[model samples]
Target: MRDIALLAILLWIIFEAFRRPWIGILGWTWVSIMNPHQLSWALRTMPFAAAIGGATLLGVLVTRGRRDYSQSREGVVLILFMMWISITLPFSMVYDDSFELWKRVMKIDVMILLALVLLHSKRHVMLLAWVLVISIGFYGIKGGAFTIATGGSYRVWGPENTYIEGNNEVALAVVMVIPLMRFLQLQMQAKWGKLLLTMCMVLMASAALGSHSRGALLAIAAMTLVMWWRGKNKFVTAVGMVVVAGALLSLMPAEWWERMNTIKTYQQDDSALGRINAWWMAWNLAKANFFGGGFMIWVPQTFAIYAPDPLDVHAAHSIYFMVLGEQGFVGLILFVTLFTMTWFTAGSLRRQGARQPETKWLSELGGMLQVCLAGYAVGGAFLSLSYWDLPYNLMILAVLGRRWLDRKEWLKEKPEPVIALPAWLRNWFRKKPRPQALP
Candidate 1:
């Protein structure tokens, strides 16, 4: 039943794409981020993402819409980084493995470029934001409930065969989305809706803490401090945050505390030692090779050559080191520069939007996105999620929000209708009294 339902939805999305290619883009984002097929038994092995992406691409070709991406600073730097990686692929120490990984990265980049072209208006931006919230929030809500039910004894995990499948990865992902949730909450006018979102934020935070990842702990702490500083009602926000942290920490088991305590004594932990070994290997490899070792460079052979302890083979747990090793110094420079420009751009957009009465939502969106990126930048230091799609999509969203403000496109979004009741209830009441008037 679940398989059939998912297939039906995919088919409908494909059908809709021909008429409105943007629908295809939304469908693609949903599949890429949620990995819904992975949750179903029969559909688990299907190439749903490829199908959705292919359909979306075909839709783009057929539909009447712009196909070119803006050559913004970030976009140009992104392309340069992409080209540099391709150049390094040929020189890869593991050519076959590198080619495979390169293919995966290119697919994600292509979708990102396509999204930038299609997602232009405020409606498009809001809809995409909701899709993002729903995709990530599902795991957060579920994990939080699980943590509560099990007393935080076990770690929360993401869907199988996805970027966030690991406990630490999902925790960081959850931490990132809390701000997006808050952004959505800000756009909402209904009291009940606002409360629901506020609850979800708490649950999502719980999910992150439940993962018991030491990196997640640091990431959330950094994210919380930034959120408090930027968030309105600062003193209240700070107090609520502190109270929530204390409560969540109190819920955690002794074993969880023991695991987190290792952060202070990392020198005594084998996992920490292994990650350090990998970081050293990445640094040494980048210094030795012009384009670094290319993809799949975490092999024993490379470690034997560059690692401090040749026997200790570990993946580059840090995104900084991951790019440094895989793409070399120039590539790392481009990578870092792209994000630095994005950060400033988001800040500029936030200030611009805050000054305008009509564009305040953009202000809120930009601020939350910065908070989201904060979590990614901090937590990602200890995870090898260098090519994860969420952060990149978020960066694009920030760029798009800035574009909207620059072009005065806020007029495209109609203000929410004023009503004493929801549209559904209003319509229902209106229908019952209309028969007498008609007669």
Candidate 2:
């Protein structure tokens, strides 16, 4: 049954890719809704590896035919850095498990390539927004049903699925989608279409609260503030403020309130002290192994050396800490470089849009991309989510790339010959078209 379903999905993806490549971009969305947990596991191991391997093969075949290497210098640098990380790691420590690291590297590489290809048109951007609305709405309804059936506290899908419990990572992903959805809402002409988008916003906001992630809550608050500051619409600003205030009041539970109020207690609590100790241990290890300790090694080593019982040890809570401990300074630098490139690219696109206001679609796309990147930057501080988190984060990156590509295509144009029209039509009915100028 699973094989058959997988085959069906692969076929659908191929068909969509041929007919509308943007639609194929929703491959992750489909994966997320149908079986988020399994997809998450697949992202971590074999499934993602196979998917990436296939994407690489497809890229090879396509490139062979087209022979276009118009990749940016920053792209080349990023790819080279990824390759360096893969090769530099000490695979000899556990040669049998080396494939795991390679799989992770390949998955990230595949996502970048996929994003670049899928984002080459405007239609793809619209398709991505549609998928976000549909998938998130489905999950929201599912969560609501579960909540209703088992009272407010009981999760419908149980602990097996992180999203079922309204996981912080999932909340962060939804928050990232907000700007794109808001942009779509602005562009959409139909009344029902706007309504659907408004509902999506509400549903996503609700799900974010359901997850009870303090970090995600903080991130969403920050994102809302940024959006309000950047947005020109006074009505949207006012509505957003009210919605945010209401969401906070309605969603926060007594326990959550207590936790927030006592967050400073972490400094004194045993669990908090443990995290501090873990950070100290991670710092010492990172200092000793300046290059890297190899992927997934630092935690186990720290557990063995520092903790009285090795069984109790787990990952360092902070993403930066995890990167430092596992991948070392070199890996950390590469990670920073990747994020920096993404930020710079998004910012550049926004500036280009601002300069060329006549290109409305391009300007909107750039603005949305900037907002999403900002949200990710804020979210990453709390969550260890990287390209490896799969389906969700990877999918978000792919959609952002697709939107940018669409804007790029929109910017490209040829000069049209000027034509004289009938005096009556030109003077009374038809508006004169503005002269086309390249930005």
TM-score of each: 0.93, 0.74
- Enumerate residue pairs that collide in model 2: 119-402, 166-211
lDDT of each: 0.87, 0.56
How many backbone collisions does model 2 have?
A: 2
For model 2 the TM-score comes to 0.74
As for model 1, its CA RMSD to the true structure in angstroms is 3.9
**For residue 386, what is the lDDT in candidate 1?**
88
What are the runs in model 1 whose C-alpha is more than 4 Å off? 66-68, 412-439
Name model 2 segments beyond 4 Å from true. 1-9, 15-56, 59-68, 91-98, 117-119, 128-137, 144-166, 233-239, 269-274, 306-312, 389-408, 411-439
Q: For residues 400-426, write the lDDT of model 1, one tens digit per residue.
A: 888899879766656653213567988
Candidate 1 residue 312 C-alpha distance from true site, Å: 0.8
Model 2 lDDT vs. the true structure?
0.56
- For residue 199, give model 2's deviation from the true position in Å: 1.4
